[model samples]
Target: MKKLLIMAALIFAAHFAYAQSENIEEIQQFIISDVRYNKADVTPIYLDAKAYISLYRVKDEETIYMANVWPAKRSQSYGYIYDLKQTSVDATDDTYKNETLTFKWSYKNDFDNKQGTATIKLGLVYKPTGIAFLMTMITEDLNVTEFKGYVSGSLNLK
Candidate 1:
């Protein structure tokens, strides 16, 4: 009877562990459609460019990737991957209905080697028939950029 009870407990523990890991495997990608640059001159320029970004959150480790989508002549379009210093997620039970997530990080580009703090906010919403997603990035002493688009999971932006 003792051996049988131990075996049953082990089985239950394994099942619970598997359920927890499934949530952590989710990765979301965002395609930037329009970029609004808020210049220091109080004039904002809107550029309709093709860019890609991704976010992956797992406990103390979160990654943000900004893809370089210019020139169209580079060997690789994948840009820098920054380690986020702070992250916050405010989500509802139905994430597609309404949700918001924010990420903060400091980065230094290889071009000028200047450090700056970057904060990105992701707004997600769901309509009766479709979904809507928007992302905005703000940096210190730099232009604030806004991206209007949706993700591949529910909405398509072209």
Candidate 2:
């Protein structure tokens, strides 16, 4: 009787662990598509070009956030793996039924022997049919040749 009870408990624990892992996989697969940069400029020059950015939630001791931005022209790309400090969603005052998702992310990057810490604010709006996103980055060690206007684009969930 004792062995049977222990076996049942172990089976139940395994099932629960599997279910939690599946949920994490679903969250990791969430994708944002059709993103383009409308305005921006960071050194290496090509970083300013329009691009598509994808976000990923990596499973670590704590969840690790990461993003990959590939230029629309396919010339250059940037990778950001960081900690997502906070996120908030709220209804927007637009006629077209939309909600805004805002995220505050922080990361460290290295460029030409110089390392810098970056704080990025990403705002995404879910439109009636599609989505739109805007991002701004502030860095301590990277030079921004052109940082006027804004980085704006459209996003589609994949």
Candidate 3:
């Protein structure tokens, strides 16, 4: 009886493993380093865990749009990823108050134990314009934060 019960439990666990999500879960585990920007140079914003920049802009000096990344699908390719959406933000300045990007996430990856961040982060210089790029870097422990959005909207997988 004990052997049969153990086998059953193993089968149940295997079922769950096989039932794993076919899509890369969108998790809220990204972070950004608060920095001061001007209408001139691109800022050195920190990537959360995938060598990625949460947000950046050359002229705004405030607010960043972080690209929430994930695998394109259940593929074995190492470069199959997608930018679900972006979280719009307003950087804190003496001229204005800092606004948090309203994000809605439903995935989780406790990646804080290792060092991973997004690379080659870029954005518009002043919204709906030229591309402002930021060379992304990584050097911290953080969770994989999915979901990016702005004050009046949200980014997610439907």
The candidate that achieves the highest TM-score relative to the unseen native structure: 1
* Superior by lDDT: candidate 1 or candidate 2: 1
Candidate 2 structure quality by residue, lDDT tens digits, 13-82: 9999687646542122112323223333243333444433445443553554444433454432233445
RMSD of each: 14.8, 12.4, 14.4
Instruction: Tell me which of candidates 1 and 2 scores higher on TM-score.
Output: 1
lDDT top scorer: 1
How good is model 2 by TM-score? 0.42
lDDT of each: 0.55, 0.44, 0.31
Q: Model 2 off-target regions past 4 Å? A: 1-50, 71-89, 92-114, 142-158
The sequence of per-residue lDDT tens digits that candidate 1 reaches over residues 1-158 is 99999999999999986875564433666655555667232112222233445554544445444433332331113333454333334456664456666766555554455666777677777654445677677877756877766665665444
Candidate 1 lDDT score relative to the true structure: 0.55
CA error at residue 62 for candidate 2, angstroms: 2.5
The digit string of per-residue lDDT tens for model 3 on 1-158 reads 99999999999988876665332342322323332222322223222222332332224234333333322321111221224344344534432322222222222233332223333222322222212332222213432222222211222324
lDDT of 2 at 9: 100
Pitting candidate 1 against candidate 3, the one with the higher lDDT is 1
Model 3 Cα displacement at 140 (Å)? 27
